[model samples]
Target chain A: MIVWLILGAAVMGFLRRVDLYDAFSEGAKEGLKSAVRIIPGLAAILTALRILQASGLMEALQRLLVPLAEALGLPGGAAPLLLIRPLSGSASLAVLEDILKRFGPDSVTGLAASAMMGSGETVLYTCAVYLSAAGIRRTRYVIPVSLAGWLAGCAVVGLFFR
Target chain B: MSAALFLMIVCGVIYAACTGRIAAVEQAVLEAGQEAARTAWRLAGGFAFFGGVIGILEKAGAVRGLVRMIRRPLRALFGRDTGQEALEAISLNLSANMLGLGNAATPMGMRAARLLSAEGGGQPSAALCLLLVINATSVQLMPTGVIALRSAAGSAMPAAILWPSLIASAASTGVGVLLCKLLERGGR
Candidate 1:
């Protein structure tokens, strides 16, 4: 991928008769601007998650999900990932690593991981990132639809894999 | 590392505020802003390039032509004509979803929604519902992000998840669309 990206940059530079360094810097600058606009949203989400974690909200949620976990054939430990899965991929991955370590690969934890691997994070985040970037605010049904799809994915994994 | 970096910044801010080190807090905010800006610019170019590719593909008639080819199968599965707008959106959405480019899928999905809305005379039609269902339960073929994570975690066969992922995604999408249609009818 690195090689392809480099080659692409090189090709663009060559075609445009621009220096590689200059072109790369230009692209980077544009990317930076896009990143800035999303900071407030990302910071707010992270802060809320941090507060939730600090207040043991996550622990309570995990405890509540334990029975469901067993019925769904997922590990109780997988609860954290299931909870975080809708919020952030990176954080969910950290939780996934914890599950994999505790339960080992090829277990139910592993299967759940496989399911998440094929799925996505919350629709709000996707909507926030893209819609905000595109400057659109009124997306009526996207959130509900995406959430339903995500829930369906989880259900399929739990029921079928069980 | 990213988490640690974030923690360090938060801690630094608190410490600085406590110590009345206004300069330190100011510097931290500036650095964070700079870092975020850099990330966004890179992301935008990528998104723009992806959106542009779809735009170019549409202009070249490739998108429409491909839509025609797949329309029958799509209609059979979706149980509706899906119109040109929905078809185009579905194609774009499917292509992006298969690539595991969730970020890239957003603009296309919105565009599809807008087109569908216009076509429906400002009402949310069944075709629009189908598009929403499909977008929500998109079938992924590559699962690139997962594969990358697996590789990073030292998986010998990062791509081994491909077939299983595809099967699972396909099944979910099928069931999801069916349920959406069923529920819509029941609601009526």
Candidate 2:
């Protein structure tokens, strides 16, 4: 799909008589600069996330949310996926797999987890990378608003898929 | 960002100490740093590739064409104060997201955010905040990854989540936009 998009872009550039190679390399250099610029922020955020995950704090938070999950008509086991969804994509994916394996894919918990994972984004990672790359210091309600969206998605998933 | 990170690390360390897992936490921080570097390296390749494509599009006036196509809706959402360049980049980011092209989405999003910031006189604009919220509550057309995983895990109906996920995604995006609108008004 992306390959097709690139090919189409090249064709479009060719028809426009643009210096496609020069344009590409110039843009690619900027891309590299921005990518490199994000490393420090990624390191900080990921290290903190890793600590949260490794020290079992993530699970502890999941445990605390289990009752809320159950109250929402989801299984207690689905709590981890919900708690971790905005934090880490890979972690939430792993939790989704764990839920599916334990509860069966067609089960209510499994379906809800799948839907929730499907709809949600890694809010922390996205905010950190984008804001840092943009060189913005103050986040200013981005996290709160994003997390509210995530919670809304999760609730919808629970209400419908479950 | 610092406050969030500080809280995470402090809470994590305290929790680890209470559970006698401080050694594991130390290991995790070291490993995470390396992992982050590795992740960044992988992202560099994708960004370069997509950036090149986007460059071609920009030079060919394709991006401008796209911006024109979505100009009204985007203007309505982001307001008239935003520049065309930011709107173009934002559209790219959003289309990639809807297509579930995460690797493509991030670079475009960063570009859009940067452009928005510049347009807002270096402060984070309402448009930028809206973009962030929308990205964080991505409206994917299909949860292809999850469906694939479900099928691999031997599910009877792996595609069952397709509509449900889309509905949930739309709901979140709607709510996010509403919240941003309300918050922008309140903040003003």
TM-score list, all predictions? 0.65, 0.95
Interface RMSD of each: 8.6, 1.5
lDDT string for model 2 (B1-188, tens) is 77888999999999999999999999998899899889889889987887788788889998888888889999999989888778888988988899988877888889888888875555578888899899988778978899998998889999998887888889888999999999898863
The lDDT of each candidate is: 0.57, 0.85
Q: Compare the candidates by DockQ and give the number of the best one.
A: 2
Docking class of 2: medium
Candidate 2, position A139, lDDT: 79
Among all windows of ten consecutive residues in candidate 2 chain A, which has the lowest summed lDDT?
A: A69-78
- Candidate 2 lDDT over A63-96, as tens digits, reads 8998887776666767887778888888888888
Stretches off by above 4 angstroms in model 2 are: B119-123
lDDT of 1 by residue, B74-187 (tens): 776544645676677767776776766754565566566555555344335555556655665556677776666666655666666566566666765666576666765764
Best by TM-score: 2
Candidate 2: the clashing residue pairs are none
Q: Which ten residues in a row have the lowest lDDT in candidate 2 chain B?
A: B116-125
Per-residue lDDT over A1-162 for candidate 1, one digit per residue giving the tens place of the 0 to 100 score = 434534554554456465545444543443345445566545544544444444444556667977766665655655665566665656677776666556554565665675655664554455454444444444445455565666556665665445
DockQ-based class of model 1: incorrect
